[model samples]
Target: MRILTKFMLGLMLVLAVACSRTPTRAPSAGPGANPQLGDSRPHSWTSGSPYGQAVHGIDISRWQGNIDWNRVRGSGISFAFIKSTEGGDHVDPNFRRYWYEAAQARIPRGAYHYYYFCRSGFEQAQWFIRSVPREVGSMPPVIDLEWTNSKTCPRRPSPAEVKREASVFMDIVGRHYGQRPIIYTTVDFYRDNRLGDMRAEFWLRSVADHPRVRYPGQRWAFWQYTGTGIVPGIQGDVDLNAFAGSRSDWVRWLNTRLTR
Candidate 1:
């Protein structure tokens, strides 16, 4: 019996190895070119290697400090998500000016709407649409829905209600932006709302580890990796994020979304 069990385990290990696949890779450097993580300049600021290549970006709210675009210019901030409006009545006072500054800095930028569980989907959608203009170079809008029982008028909507309202909001934003919007949520909030049932790409917040444990078998386009990432570009501590796959994946993503 022991011999048979060992044989079975070995076979399973072999099968698992055979079935596994790798993330897609970027093109190799051209004849005279040097890659950022290549020969002359290996990827900086890494101790133990990351699970995937580091493609850094940040998400900001008005609580952050006054940002200097020039200081952040070469800090490798590839993209940003600036908070626009939240819960219908509470708008981020600095959103408009900061968003404009980010755009002026020639950085790719997107906007987000903070979802209110008690509010109507159309109401939130309209607020986001009104706050953000439909510009060609801007990235698609994002819907941020995380639970907070401490909210002044917190009404914990049922999972079904969460899905319905989020869909309506996404559809309205999608029509205006001409692309499907990304959904941002935390592990607990998503599981509580059962947001996995919603058909939108994800930008998940998992500062400790990858979402494999929190959201098993789910796909996320971006991962907010650290709440305390210190980059020279932005003042104060900014939440740092990683693009889901290799550098090649970003090339493909932008090619379809922003053709520059």
Candidate 2:
């Protein structure tokens, strides 16, 4: 009877230990936990990581080449920024097709213009306005500013000159589209041109770290976290961006920000 009691006690103790042990839990498949967003060159983010944000998007141009918009939308892409015009006359070869396909897929998409330092801001804005239609329910226009090492036109204007041109571009485009233009810029361009001083929503490029770390004291609408992103429909690598808000916040932003 004593042996039986000892065995029972041991069994009880074993059961108790088992109960006390923490159960191995499956990883959460909640918002921001998307398996589709694979990066070719992934960054180990510490603080201010964009992965936690629920609203994610992509920016594409001709380089992406014949995208499957349906697959892209299904792969958890909430929005897109299609490259429209560059310089004073150059239009992205795939802009119209991408715009139509993305709309058909029900993805809220915007158009962005690449600012060329060689041309005046007015000329660039005019080119962009001419190329992209002022469609209702579309996302706002964007001005992409960056210093290039181009052999043709490698003019690095002063901060004052940069700001002046940027303002002109934004004002002209904003008036035409009836929505404020968002500035898309790199860390080097932002710093060199002192873009933080501008009163415009920024879509910043910071692949290694968070935009807050790269562009201190700057409020950003979108963060381009990875250029080598492997989206489902995109042929090779693509730029992945994260909106700076929750899902609900994203909805609210779109409602208020989209061009009328």
Candidate 3:
């Protein structure tokens, strides 16, 4: 309980600071790939780091504010996943801007929805479908599942129930997008929820170490290596991610796996 509280408080502090530091004017061109900004510690985790030759990317939300997409692309970020909606009604204010800007900058982008435990899965899926447009060349949609920690709707259902809800949500989203939606989850939630058994791609979050060391034999399409990353275009820290293969492998996966 103490640790959770501290984590929540630390996250709140970071969000406050990040929001306050948002840029007001157009962003300027700056450094591209800065190796010093990432986790360069010599270890297995660092070996598979996003800083390696693989295709790198980032995930953003309203907290990121206005971004210079061109600068981000120049910074070796080949793709992006932008938060589009949450629950059944909350649409990210920056989703449209990010979507448009990403397209203009030729960044392969996808939309993600933050799953709400309190809300019905079908309703949330409908909300996401309405919020995000179906476009060619876009990466598969993502469903972010994790603890809500909400007082108003703090319901942690049984494992069976959680799996059922996820199925319904993924099914609906897949039908709408014409692509299998990826699941974005924390290590604890993935283990506790039996997410590996689910027949969907995964985007894992492992900040302290590589997913290979943390998840151990689990395959992931994307690895969110760090939350506090310093990219050129972003004002504050951004979440950095890496594809699971080489540059050619990434392009092939994007071409063959993604649905129009």
- lDDT (Cα atoms) of all candidates against the true structure: 0.69, 0.83, 0.76
Winner on TM-score (2 vs 3): 2
Model 1 bad stretches (over 4 Å) = 1-51, 258-260
lDDT head-to-head 1 vs 2, winner: 2
**By descending lDDT, how would the candidates be arranged?**
2, 3, 1
Runs in model 2 deviating more than 4 A are 1-32
Model 1 TM-score, 2 decimals: 0.78
> After TM-score superposition, what is the CA distance of residue 22 in candidate 2 from its true location, in Å?
28
Which lDDT tens digits does candidate 1 get at residues 92-200? 9889877777766666678888888767999989888878877665667899989866547578888898888889999988888888889999989988877887898
What's the true lDDT of residue 242 in model 1?
71
Model 1 residue 141 lDDT?
86
Candidate 1, number of clashes: 0
lDDT of 1 at 221: 88
- Best model number under lDDT: 2
**Residue-level lDDT tens digits of model 3 in 1-260:** 44334433543453354345533332222211234234323224443444553457889999998898878877667789999998998999999989878877767789999988888889989899889987755789999998788787789887788889888999999998899899999988988887778889899998777787778888998888777777778888788787887654765676666656
- The TM-score that candidate 3 achieves is 0.82
The digit string of per-residue lDDT tens for model 2 on 192-247 reads 88888898999999988888788899998999988988889999999999888765
